[model samples]
Target: MGLSVENSVTQSHTRTHKTFLITNYMLLGAASACIFLTLSLRLLPSLCGFFLILLHVVTIASAVSGCSIVTSGSNKSYAAHMVAMVLTSIFQGSVSVLILTRTSDFLGYLKSYVREEEGETILKLAGGLCVAVFCLEWVVLGLAFVLRYYAFVEGQSAHPRNERVSEEELKNWPWPFQV
Candidate 1:
């Protein structure tokens, strides 16, 4: 029975790991697509264009870093990953709303060389993708938290509760710190 329970836990962990990888890959592709769509508007040379592309670049970077966060033992790395994901998700959502609601004004700001109608269409498509990226970022954040929980559980299990610290070992501690 114990063996079966361990096997089930391993299977659950494997499934979660796979889902995490798949979501990150989808996020990368969506972010890349948004960059291409932005370029299609011929806004690459403008300041607004530069920042738009930079935002997607940062999203891609965060997603890439997320893949390794599970194996990294440092608390700092986990905290940084959480911060990046939250910021990117917020920015992506705001951009999508702006693109969808104020298409013409946004195009004027971007100084896009494309015709008004074409630019609006492209912006809408990119906005839709931004929404996807935003949702995926949050999903990835949740999965990362779950993975960390699993790691903590496994680590605790490794040190059996049946083993007690000997009194002699306990007495060797620094004076005030002794339990």
Candidate 2:
């Protein structure tokens, strides 16, 4: 009877922790997505740029939180989602710097002087890179959302008391749950 009580308490604690951890992950993913969108839309007024920068900061924080969860071995799908967030954050940060610094203008001038055709090619290449990164991020976001959905579904069902897992379970969760 004592063992059963202990097990029940443990299960309850585990369930609470799992939900809390999941909440953190979802929020992180959401914040990362918000940053990506805001930064991508930055234009015109420098104030927008400032907002983008702020968003980037938030993205980094989200990435960190995601990383912590991944390291904790909470859920593989969640880990994978965090990895995506980290990658997106790094790419966004670099891209933001490039855009804000007029790096493109400098590169364009250099290309134009050396080879007009080549300069146009370089411009196209840069644009293509941006598009690719943005598209990839969108894909990641979609995957994250889908994964989160699956997680929600899985958690929606109550587990039999006797079957409570001691170690975190990543089985068939979805997406990058086992990352």
Candidate 3:
């Protein structure tokens, strides 16, 4: 009987620890991807880059919300998710102004290198795509908010930490497959 109890407790702790790690990994991946995409914006035209930038913004917001939800309790999750969504919406939406300004300033240069009508159409389409992306992000953020709120209100707390790693100890974490 003692052995069985010990086994069960061990299994429970393992599961809790694994869940925490997975959630943390997800948030970190999202944030990293956003930063990478944001830095690559210079490779594309202003309009196209603007659309990509919005995607990065959405990814960053999602990452922040996910990290908050995983680390804090449900109440904090809802608050964090809401805040990230609002900030992303405002910042992402306004970023179109930069796109417009940049494109306008560079119009003459672009015209000299390409056909005017074709370039105009491409620019228009790119602008349209930017708007579409922003709208989609807004909708997704709303759904995430709702889901987070539902989860929070249900008293569903994640498993307790099974072990502790001091901040200083993190420096010794093994590289992938090295441990």
Please report the candidate that would top lDDT against the real structure.
1
lDDT of each: 0.93, 0.50, 0.51
Off by over 4 Å in 3: 1-81, 97-116, 156-179
By descending TM-score, how would the candidates be arranged? 1, 3, 2
Q: In model 2, which range of ten residues has the least summed lDDT?
A: 106-115
Residue-pair clashes per candidate, as listed? 0, 6, 0
Instruction: Please give the lDDT score at residue 90 for candidate 1.
Output: 98
Clash pairs, candidate 2, are 76-176, 76-177, 76-178, 77-176, 77-177, 77-178
Residue-wise C-alpha lDDT for candidate 2, range 1-179, written one tens digit per residue: 98897678567656555554555555455555544433343332455345444644655465455434433435775766566565655665465456446644634433233344454444344434444444444544554454455445446644554774533575656667555
The list of candidate 1 runs beyond 4 A from truth reads 160-162, 166-179
Q: Candidate 3 at 160: error in angstroms?
A: 20
Choose 1 or 2, whichever is better by lDDT. Answer: 1
> Over 4 Å off in model 2, which ranges?
1-104, 108-116, 158-179
TM-score of 2: 0.33
lDDT of 3 by residue, 113-156 (tens): 34555554444444444454456456555555444454454334
